[model samples]
Target: MTVGPAEARRLSWAQVRARRLAWHGLAEPLKGAGPADVASAMAGTHAQMMSAAELGIALRMDGATRADVREAVWGEHSLIKTFGPRGTVHLLPARELPMWVGALSALPRPSSPHADGVRMAPEQSEQVIAAVGDALRDAELTIDELTEEVVARTGPWAGDLVMPAFQGMWPRWRQSMHEAGIRGLLCFGAGRGRKVTYTSPRRFLPGFAAEEPEAALRGVVRSYLRAYGPSTPQRFAHWLNAPATWASELFASLEAELERVEVEGVDAPQWLAPDASASAFAVPRPRDVAADVPRGVRLLPYFDVYAYRVGNQPPALLYPGRASERVLRGNFQVLLVDGEVAGLWHQRRSGRRIEVTVEPLAPLSRARRSALDDQVARVGEILEARPTLTIGEVTVGGHA
Candidate 1:
């Protein structure tokens, strides 16, 4: 990539932080945005824990509730539940499914982690994906029901339950279920009591199809950069679980639409999508770099998209002070003050009350402490509960 005064630019870490906060709607709650609006803005919300996903979206909007997120997913059919970035379940905007499918389907599949005998062959894997789509074409089936149909159609071998999960073995065909979702062949259906169900994505938007690979690639990259830029190819790769080499080449392919930039304290160069709003490079105002840099207190739930800066450099940059300890554990709920992770927190809920325990790296100012209270109350509102605050150590390990 070419570097020059005309094209090259630099941003103080403060500028990047402020921009990211506003871009993510954490600077203030969005006024008219819906659940799908927030979901699409963040690319998608990690949804292995659906409640956490609902919280992630709800907490971003002005007075939005968990029920609002659920309605978007089930009642309004505006949000789709499917395997998204890095092959994890996510709540993606239904309107963006074509682009997600095209881009995700292009991701290189990881080699099987199972024993040779337990894994499917190349042709068998394809057959399993196709059968999954066909099985759920018209009906939403729970895991067991879908497994029975897959084995019946793809032959008895597909039902071999050998890969141990938590405790018991899971059906062999289950291994390819996520791949089916990425292929736009199937998606999550409404839960049947306690059981999760699977159905075709086509059920929500009939005649859906992925865009051309190149077009979809360009669209998703732009979408990601809009929410997470001024970023680097490596960080982008890590965010989507794509190879660094692939990200580099893809960025190279779109050179005309991107500009290289430097962030204070970052070793390697970064990239950003250029915009016309403020003309050349559209750099942040000088004051944003050093003063009043997006001050606010936010309680981000587990796997919150804005808090997960995948492969970010200088851990101190985001997870400052004691926050690193929590981040290292990998899944503690995050506490953000002034756009940086300043503490770690968790919540427990009873019938009408929520107990929030916060562990700050340093004593908070009266103003920030008050903001924290407001943030906690907002969390309770989203969950429809009364909130009580406690300041102490969190006694749990983290993983996601």
Candidate 2:
């Protein structure tokens, strides 16, 4: 069954879910895939659909390690460059870092009045760089330790001024690192004692070097489409939090490598892999038998990419008026069936036991409920003796 580009682009929402789940190994993070690889694969699979945090949680990484993956992928420590979209830091993958940075930088400067009284001049940046170099010369230091050293060497002024200075020169620092092919944020370490520590930049692995901006952008764009293709340019633009004009430019730059198609009933054009033939349309079907349901429950961390991939479509479909409100305030771990979000789940741990609370967005037929139960059991098995399904809640329209 040869699938044309148009049909492939016009896949049902279910098909899209199946395709993405298959790419991520849905029920589990693929064996042998580390945090970096998991992140890279998610970005590649969903294209622009997955966020840095989502990828991190899928791989079950902590905050410190998440930062390390971000640095390794995007070659930067912070997500602040140009202020468009949400004006928040996003963990950009390494291969696509340049384009995202460039696109964001092209936007107008935000008028938020540059945080009062926090300014770092070029000379200050140099001093900080020197301090960082010295600290990382032999071994990496936790952010606290590194900050302390910078403050000590540069004086009290450096104490308050270093972070601001780092933020100010972040763009330049990132550009230099990207150009030299030096990747930052390699590994994460435990904090002093049991406290959580911030991820630090490191020269962990080799093989990354700088390249022409256009070349880098092209590679990034291609990778995005490979993982998250069959998506509209608007969705891509929204995902990147970039302007449509910049998105168009990037899309044009990647024209030679991508194929554009219009889904059968949809009016807008979508982009997909050039070689994604009809066979790509053969998405895995939803299981009908209870016994055939895939085992394993995924404890998706807060801000998983699955929700972000469709650019807020999930909220619109599931919660309607409450999408924005719930997403902003709640930390929801959705239950997956095959690939679709079958329900919402919450976890509460007391002592050594972790309780999983599931609330289905839609009324589950008996078969679907049984499938979800199997998934919950699998999750219990993975957690061994530590996590247990203490409560199972199935709600329809807010009551379980």
Candidate 2: TM-score?
0.62
Q: Residue 210 in model 2: shift from native, Å?
A: 4.0
Off by over 4 Å in 2: 1-9, 27-37, 44-113, 119-134, 152-156, 161-187, 195-202, 263-267, 274-299, 305-308, 311-315, 318-329, 338-342, 390-400
Model 2 has a clash total of: 14
- lDDT tens per residue, model 2, 146-258: 66766676656655532234335322222111211122322233335754233333342234333455665565555456556556666777765556777787776666677
Model number with the top TM-score: 1
Local accuracy of candidate 1 as per-residue lDDT tens digits, 1-400: 4555456677777777777776566777655788887876677888988888888889888888999999999998999999999888899999899999999998766688888889889899999998998998899999899999999889888998877899799988888888999999989999999899989989889999998889999888877776677778888888888888998999989877876777789878777664324321122322343344667898888888344464345568888766776665578787888878887888888889999999888899999999999999999999989999998987766632
What is the Å distance of residue 398 in model 2 from its true position?
16
Q: Lowest-lDDT window of 10 residues in candidate 2?
A: 174-183
